[model samples]
Target: MDNEGVFVTKRSIKWLATLALSASLPAAASTCGDQGVWLQVLGSGGPEVGDQRASSSYLIWHNGKARILVDFGSGALLRFEEAQAKIEDLSAVAFTHFHVDHSGDFPALVKASFFSPRTAPLPVLGPSGNHLLPSTEQFVTRLFNESSGVWPYLSDHLSGNGAYPLIPHELASNSTQPTTVWEGVSAKLSGVGVNHGPLPAIAWRADIGGKSIVFSGDMSGRSGTLEKLAQHADLLVAHNAVPESARGVARRLHMPPSVIGTIANAASVTEVVISHRMLRTLERKEETERFIRDSYKGLVHFANDLNCFAVP
Candidate 1:
């Protein structure tokens, strides 16, 4: 290995030791409470499964209430249950795009919400469709509409007093800037498009209790648009799907650690939490941290399944 690789490996060993020590400590009380907003990572892995991390799903709790669910990837439904988060309390569900790894569990979540006792409509937000891609409205319609969908059984049930209604909103594709998706309970939601293959991907930003947190759905590379949308955010949740060494191929579908770091740095975010890891990223955790630390001079964390962080 080269000098940089060797340094990274050494750092990895140190971090692994630290992680071991941290795990040995008694389980702390669930930090989520009425005073602060807490973010629980339901799934931190990518599409692959070698590392045992679940795919992308996040539970954002504001004032001790589950307020939003960002992304619903594979294995997320079970992870959500494991986290013991209430789907009924969610004010909105936002999708970065239509990619399977980022949205595979959506149908399951909707089905579960149908059985919950939520009396209000759950708003769904996603990217607008182009000629090549279906809009968020079309996507939901293709799944839950009455005439032609597998979940048509839900159509009648979701409308009457017995069922939970779903309100879907398709974000404009050509929006000049960030646009609001939902607002309530001292929370405001907005989104912006980012690079993620041909699919029209969106990055969501939520403001709660005067703090801002941005989730960069799946981006193809570092995005100025994302930086603008995430400016001065207290936390930036970015996808760390590949290592810096795999930059060449990863640039087409996901962001490398260095690119993510640059975006976090440019956005002036106070903390960067890297999620969406695959086997390659899991194996080179130190390398990813080192690359990010090189550009971002802020708190950086590698997200794991069931990991929780608080917005102070």
Candidate 2:
């Protein structure tokens, strides 16, 4: 419950390319005779400026390949490679929010991918923007396409040679129920908006094979849609950024361990993985676990960078 393996072989790489090209996406990568999906904690820390750990990020590996990336935070690209996750195997990325700690390493990832031999397009899903922030389309364009973006060289990545296309998807920030975002050979993705103060954030759920993993992202305890999206999930990846009951302004945007525990228990999740680890939460692991254990009896694991959890 507190531990996380990653073994890659030549056969796996061959299968990865074959799968990536043949199907263009996973149809039931989890449902086949294969084992199940694997989730890796690519980043374990939050926005602490210059922390040693990576920021909030994760990987959803199916059929022995890292196919879906949950976030692209600072230092995550390094961890992603450290875990031996091939850049070419990634099919899509879901950004819970645009917070630097959650989506900061995107440019680095793209830069790294340029060195790989990938030909397929990479799909990106993000929350709809409002007056305060840019929508997913605007974000991607401004970051990689528009002339005003930081990286002017990436403007034509979506349709140019020697570049894997970046397909951007902007989800409605008001969605409460799960809406299918992407479907692959073995994976089906869904997104549902959750309250996160003024930030337009959303939680993501992926069903691979037959098992399910729900990512709570960052949420204020008020969203009941999280429970619905997480129902009967095999694993619930909840952020451990706040305390048991959270205090002050943090309470308005982050869910405490108790609230997270209740959501997992109510949804009858088989396991819970606490990530997006912050200094306060990391220092008070025992206290945080105690509050969570009070409501959820299932296994609870505090995540660390590169920890891989098998989604069974």
Candidate 3:
């Protein structure tokens, strides 16, 4: 019963797990094709300090192109570039909420992509309005509007120019089911609002070439919407911002590890990727893992920034 001298090595287990995953990936090419799909963790940190991690962000890649960009928090832009994702190739940009930690890098992405030769309309999608933060369309206008936005020049360049038009798709959800927010050549995005205290947030799920990946944006576990959105997903990227014993304000805004398992189990996801790790959860990772493991039996990983998982 001695729990002493137990050496905990960071990244070892996840490294091996991902290595085995990579072997199943389709033969070398930029495009994933039907043989594979993958996720690139841009930022795995939460709102506050998280060692070297950036805030919540993720990318879904297929056929050598970044098909979807989810969230754009602090430090995410750098990580996005480091991952070599071309904005021109992105089918859409989805935000879980308007919180800075989840949607801060929008202007940067727009500015960066403006320079690219991309002429297609870029879809930006998020939950419906809440008084707590600006609505998705308002968020885009406030940052890129001609007169009031931060980058007025982008008003013409980012939109209405027939080039690099950033189209905002604000989901005014009146139902609990996952609604399709975007559809493209090989990707389809669906979203449903989730409980996040007073903030309007949503969980997103992407079906690419018949494979699915769901992102459980910041949530309080009060709503059953997450389970519906994540149903039968190939990977479930749930936030591990708190532990089983989380209380007070934190518990009101985020779901701990056990709740994550419950949702993952209910949804029947093929894998569980625990992200948005805060200091509290990182310090007790073993305990967090155990809590989730108790409820969900699937491929689970404590994701690190830039980690890639080739979807099976």
Candidate 4:
């Protein structure tokens, strides 16, 4: 292996050119079936601007209806509409972190939901905060707190005076074990703390209709907490933000392909979906897939905006 831990071969040059060309093409139309649980990629790109794709967001569909939302990054609102999802149909919304790319469009979603028919309190769950980050409740309060919030007009949502109140649930950030955040007749949600450098972050798992799907968020994989939450999951949505050669702060914030592979392998997940694509990792798709395959023998899919996968 090279210094960056990337496997270097004589065919690397030829492969790079081919993979880059493929990466530039528009993603093919992929839609999930209508009969069971489905995962839809709302925003496939990361925090970058040039990718044309939106930032990180995801939707979980159960029996043709959107049941849960995993994140609401930039441009995700538009994608949600395009996917024919209804805010009223969502049982809860879980965030991986409070990063702009992961939660920037939250207020926008709340604003849009004003027109929806949902009357029940919406459950919003996220990680507990440390000194560097605000807790989930604090994050929501700072956004909609009546007196000092950025959107004071919409503060009624927090005060139970709006169309529907928002109930914020904060998962402990120091715990590696999964903690249940929300539970319903057919759906149960859990989360665990993850390593995202100094930022407070967590990964989410949803169990619905006898199927399990885990979102890895933007973890660096150093905490080793994801394995327990993702164990034996039907689908794992892992972030492929940086290449194996990435180092310094980039390495500290996001997991490389090798770590993703190891986690999926160790967790024994059925399939892996890699999202949070950035320009840096887009052209290096082949190399990333190669490293992930080095450890994980299961299915690996590179995510695209609007791409859908049915849980089987």
lDDT of every model, 2 decimals: 0.77, 0.80, 0.80, 0.88
lDDT of 2 by residue, 191-228 (tens): 99999998899899988878899999988868788999
- Score every model by TM-score: 0.87, 0.87, 0.88, 0.91
Instruction: Please report, as a residue range, the 10-residue window in candidate 4 with the lowest summed lDDT.
Output: 1-10
Best by lDDT: 4
In candidate 1, stretches whose alpha carbon ends up further than 4 angstroms from where it belongs are 1-31, 157-162, 174-176, 247-249
Candidate 3 wrongly placed segments (more than 4 Å)? 1-35, 157-159
> Model 4: per-residue lDDT, tens digit, 1-312?
001112335656744543454454434445656778989999999999899899999999998889999989999999999998999999999999898999999999999998999898899999999888889999999999999998999999988888899999989887889989899879999999999999999999999989999999998999999999999999999999999999999999999999999999999999888899999998887689788977986667788899887775
Q: Model 1 clash pairs? A: 195-220
Full-model lDDT, candidate 2: 0.80
Largest TM-score belongs to which candidate?
A: 4
In candidate 1, where is summed lDDT lowest over 10 consecutive residues? 1-10
Stretches of model 2 off by over 4 angstroms after superposition: 1-35, 49-51, 159-162
Q: How close is candidate 4 to the true structure, as a TM-score?
A: 0.91
Residue pairs of candidate 4 with colliding backbone atoms: none
